[model samples]
Target: MKKDITIPVITDVYVAVVNEYNDIYKTQDWNAYIINDKDVDLDMVIIVTDGYSEKKMTSVFRKKLDVLPKKSYAKIELMQEDLFALNNRFKVSFFEGNTMYDKTYVFRKNTINLKALQNIPLMEAKGVLVK
Candidate 1:
């Protein structure tokens, strides 16, 4: 009898690049060039609405990145299912008088890829992260 071996396949999932801006300026103007792309830039002062946890985390992450030193960039990659799992985790109450939604997403250590934002970067031209 021959035994069949099963191999787990790893695939490149979705990726997001975040950027944050200081409250002193308007984000729209600074982000005019990158908003259309999957990449995002946010201001220090972020507005939050009800039932919008996903958007909130996304905003906070961007803001944090914006405050980082110039020429910095971060990349996050996660499987579609893992991303949604995180979303569900944040939906539940995990803090005193607050939920994960109220806080920035706790990115797993080493999961974020940081690098210098090059002039006319590849991501800027492609408008997408290619694995």
Candidate 2:
């Protein structure tokens, strides 16, 4: 029954796009990161990334992590500047103990620019976050 179902509220988890200096290229690059700000560890983390618009679409990308420790982060992918024009989505799923949780984070079209940068919690650097 609907009344008996439990829907967990996801908090403290976030997807952020940070612009950092690339040592090999000697240039700034945009990268995606998954931040786990929760107090407990998360297990079996899976993230699916995709992007689309009316006239264009991107290939689906998947990333997996065995465990994400408390108050830590992992780099998901290197986001190209071209992706900024499309609506990007990141679907995250993971487990806390015996319970499973999932959520989707989206960065709307043209929303990943410098104008949208902010202080990303736990990551010390500034970037665009979809919480």
Candidate 3:
């Protein structure tokens, strides 16, 4: 079988429990059967931006997750629409470095696992690159 080629980009990926509103939870209490169950369906992975400040971003990101539902899955996916929106929201000015800001891309949970979590790779090419 031929191995697929993957291009790397700038972004961080994480696995967490997601709710119907697309909220993410990293705490133990928020843990749901679907996330813990190996047989459950893998939904979408949310790719959040690094933000201007890591400390502030962490708090904001956590708050974003807190708003999500705890018992359901969010239908949010990293698609063209989301990409465009993210691109506009994350500007170069958002960061201290002189880097161009591209919307973060996240994989659907089905494509990720423990091993995958060890290293979350970013997509290099422009636009949404789904596996």
Candidate 4:
């Protein structure tokens, strides 16, 4: 017999990256969000850069949120450059129902290889959770 393994589905909290183009600066902007779907409120929410363990890059961005109410979201704007490069990782931590939760997400630029997005006026990547 063969054993099967399954990854747990995250149900209580979710995170997303929102990207936008700045017309005034002619640069890109990134915003992230944390949504709490459970009845409990999340507290001490923090987002930090997790440089690749074997790499020599330093995280240039950090943000903190006091609380995320149930069925609501908390938002933060990320640093504007080199977001798609390798070793750019995001880690989020929070407490829900007195339990701590933490997760990390790495940018997989190649997986989102859509050259056409470069030509579009506005590219939206909404409701995208950790992958």
In the range 24-124, model 4's lDDT, one tens digit per residue, is 88976665566676787778988786444345566557888888777776665554445455445777787766667777766554322234133211223
Output the number of the TM-score-best candidate: 2
Clashing pairs in 3: none
Instruction: Give the lDDT of residue 22 in candidate 2.
Output: 90
TM-score of each: 0.19, 0.97, 0.21, 0.61
Worst 10 residues of 3 by lDDT: 87-96
Error of 1 at 17 (Å): 3.0
Candidate-wise lDDT, in order: 0.26, 0.96, 0.25, 0.59
- Candidate 3, residue 92: CA error in Å? 10
lDDT of 1: 0.26
Of 1 and 2, the candidate ahead on TM-score is 2
Considering lDDT, which of the candidate structures 2 and 3 is the better prediction for this target?
Answer: 2
| Model 1 stretches astray by more than 4 angstroms | 1-5, 20-25, 28-131
Model 3 misplacement above 4 A: 1-93, 97-100, 119-131
Question: What ranking emerges by TM-score with the best candidate at the front?
Answer: 2, 4, 3, 1
Q: How many backbone clashes does candidate 1 have?
A: 2
Total backbone collisions for each predicted model = 2, 0, 0, 0
Per-residue accuracy of model 3 over 40-119 as CA lDDT, tens digit each: 22222232432222223221231112222323333222322222222211111111133322333334323322232231
